[model samples]
Target: MIPSFRLFPDSASTVSGEVNGFFICMLILCSLMAIGIAALIIYSCLRYHRAHERAIGDQRRYNVPLEVTWTVVPFVLFVGMFVWGARMYFDIERPPDNAISMYVVGKQWMWKIQHPEGQREINTLHIPIGQPVKLTMTSEDVIHSFFVPAFRTKQDVLPGRYTTTWFEASKAGKYHLFCAEYCGTKHSGMIGWIYAMPRKDYQTWLTQGAAEGSMASMGEKYFHQFGCANCHHFNNQGRCPDLRNLYMRPVQISTGETIIADDNYLRESIYDPNAKIVYGFHANIMPNFTGVIQPEQVAEIIAYIKALGPQPGAQEPSNPGTAPSTYGAQKGLAGPGATSISGSEVQER
Candidate 1:
């Protein structure tokens, strides 16, 4: 069982127990060192007291073994701690491939959250337990942070960019959420709750009176509205790189630097368009749509890109009340009357 002690937050995540246990061990080690040093000071003062005014203290200045023992012991302890922390950090940063994706938008005094099924919530988040959930967050205006003490996960939500973080809740319950950043006068009031429910209950909560469309569906519509297909056509020549299957792939930049095309890279390529120029592609062609769209809309665009990639299982339910859906087709992805250039099209050209 996980301990619910006052020294730290409740150990509720998979890594929380291991992390907190290491923390507790370090704390005990430090406390013991402090107490031992204090005791030595008192003992030395009493033993070399000036009660006999003419007593000369022993010149035992350099005990090589004692000095080496203290030095090597702390060094070994520190290296072990560093390795343990590094492994945990690796696990925390890279979410599992089967993890679900969610979006979060931070505003002045509220948080806007969106699930895959297009369920929307303000100042609250609902998630299913025993599954990994990755959250790609951004800010509307200033800087904001998503903090949950129970899950031991906190990531800063910044404007004009994407920050991704993930967590798998170990238990099912309601936990407190706070904006750890001090943005404005109402910073303290920017609080919410994370409800980790059972898987069956979570699916029921998703379909109950909520929108039926997925993020990919909304992103597909946005892709057509912004006229991105004009330059990014399948049989198109040397204008812009084909964006098919671009997520998580490494692209060589103009400066001979290879970087993973993750969420942040995709956001930058859409907003700035000139920051990291592709090695073979020319710059100054794609229009910068920074201020034209909102942060959450960019998230939808990203969702559409990810959906365009290889889908392992069945697709999520689309929005019911909308038009007849032609979703999930990799070819002519913009529906019936369009070119058929897809990721496969890039090779033929």
Candidate 2:
């Protein structure tokens, strides 16, 4: 019996061929440069050796064309490589707007994955072929890396922040998943498999074990459970900033900095409420849930917030006065020092 070996992993992603081609080009270029230099050194030694003890060597100083050709040729090739690599990088980093959103939480010895449809899996991911899948990943403990060789995609998952990577599987099969970063004693055991199925089969699999409802629905439950709805009311009359229609919108902070309300901003707002106070709002009003809420719960809460799509015909405020703010004297939910501050007064601050 004979064993078969492969020089490269299966190319199962849209970008895998491009990655392989770029890598081969670089390998060939470097290999040829090395071989050419070695051969030239050998040829020069043989051609320029002294024939007799009194032989005088040619006193050539320098060749302008030769020097310029070597320098300029390598420079152009390197610049071309840089441009090609940069374009590939941006394409990989930016996920398509229509890509399916998935969540991943890295912990010691395991990869916990959740789909928008509420399907949960440990150490295994099921994705659809020919459809882009964007993974919003973070770590609960230490730094971890999400790597799929077949997809030619790898992104670092770090604690206290979110990082994303996307891939569209071109082939339908099972591919290996690995935690590229060395984590703990079970680092070698931290492995998984990605099952890329056809669209119909993937949809069927989504319906099988999703009894827990969608992530947004579960997030809504947590929204009320944590009393987030008490202040962040749906009617836009809450004592705190109205959370409705906040996702992916520009938010003006107290420091006059405008930032997009993305997943990372939402996560930071939950864990460290005072980090970036919304404009026309007082700092230290919202309690920090750093120790109270887990990372997965935070993700769910952000999902719920994202599910709160933009309000119809909700125009952006022309000035600070028109921005949503707490008004009149209402009973406060945020314990002791809670008091209703008028929108006009907060704007002056």
Judging by lDDT against the true structure, name the best candidate: 2
The residue ranges of model 1 lying beyond 4 angstroms of the native Cα positions read 1-8, 43-59, 235-239, 252-258, 277-282, 312-349
Cα lDDT tens digits, model 2, 127-216, are: 999999999999999999999999999998999999999999999999999999999899889899999999999999988875587777
Q: Count the backbone clashes (under 3 Å) in each candidate.
A: 2, 0
Q: What is candidate 1's lDDT per residue for 1-349, written digit by digit as tens? A: 6766565666777777888887889889999999999999999898768767677877778989999999999999899989999998877766665678899999998999988778888999999999989898989889999999998888899987888789999899999999999889899999999999999999999889467577778877787799876787644363776676555545567887666567898889889999998777789999998887667778888887766654523332321111223222222222212122233323220
Leading candidate by TM-score: 2
What's the TM-score of each model vs. the native? Answer: 0.80, 0.85
State residue 321's C-alpha deviation in candidate 2, in Å.
26
RMSD of each: 8.5, 8.2
Scored by lDDT, model 2 comes in at 0.80
How many clashing pairs does model 2 include?
Answer: 0
The list of candidate 2 runs beyond 4 A from truth reads 1-3, 45-59, 310-349
